[model samples]
Target: MKMIDLTGTTGVIFGVANHRSLAWAIAEQLGQAGARLAFSYQGERLKENVAMLAAKLPGSIIFECDVTDDDAMARGFAEIGTAFGHLDYLVHSVAFARKEDLEGTFRDTSRDGYRLALEISAYSLLPMARLAAP
Candidate 1:
C-alpha cells in the first residue's frame, strides 16, 4: 500500500463543530495525506474545540468565518491567503437550518429560515471560491 503524498498542498475546511464532525474527519484524512490545512470555525463558542482539533495536525490553523457575514468571510480568506499564499483546495461542509424549520416538511419552513439555509449552505461557496481562486 502507498500513502498519498500531498506534501505541498494547502487547503481549508469549513464547518468543523467538533471531533465528530464530518468536516473534522476530512481534516484528519487530509492531514494524514500531508496537506497543510486551515479550519474555519463559525463563532467564538467553537474556537476552542476547533483549535484543539487542529493542534493534532502539525501546521494546522483555525480562523473564524461566518458564512452569513460577507465581511467576515472576506477577512477570513484574507487571513488564509496571508498565511498560505494560495489555496490548493477547499472543503465546504457547512449547512444550517433553524431548529423549528427542521420540524416538518420543507414547505412548512419559514421564508427566513430557508433563506438563511441557502445563504450558509450554498451561496457561501461563491465568494470563498473567488477568494481561493488566486
Candidate 2:
C-alpha cells in the first residue's frame, strides 16, 4: 500500500484555544502528516494559548480571528493566502455558548444568548467555508 503523502499541503486550523482543544489535536495530526499549518484565536486569552501551541510547531503562523466579525475573518484568510499562497485543508473546531445555556432549560435562555450562540457556532461555519473555498 502506498502511504498518503501530505507534504507541501497547507492546512488552516481555527478555534484552537488550549492544549486540550480538538483543533490542537487535528493540528498535531496534520503537522505529523507534513502539512504546513496556520492557526486562529478568538481573543487575547485564546491567542496566548494558541501561541504556546504554535511554539511547538516551528514556522506555524497564528492570527486573531473572531469569526463573528466579517472583517477579521476576511483579513485572516487574506493573510493566510498571502503567506502560504494556497490551502489544501481547513479545520473548524471552534464553538461558543453562554454559561447559562450550557446548564439550564431552553426556556430560560435569553434571546440574545440564543442569537449569539447560533451566530458564533452555526453561522461561523458558513463564512469560513466561503473564505477558504477555491
Most accurate candidate by lDDT: 1
For each candidate, give its TM-score against the true structure.
0.94, 0.91
Candidate lDDT scores, in order, read 0.91, 0.87
Candidate 2: Cα lDDT at 121: 79
Give the per-residue lDDT of model 2 (tens digit) for 28-91.
8778777789999887777788888987876689888999999999999998998899988899
lDDT of 1 by residue, 28-82 (tens): 9899988999999988899999999999999998899988888998998888888
**Reference-based TM-score, model 2:** 0.91
How much lDDT does candidate 2 score? Answer: 0.87
lDDT (Cα, 0-100) at 73 in candidate 1: 84
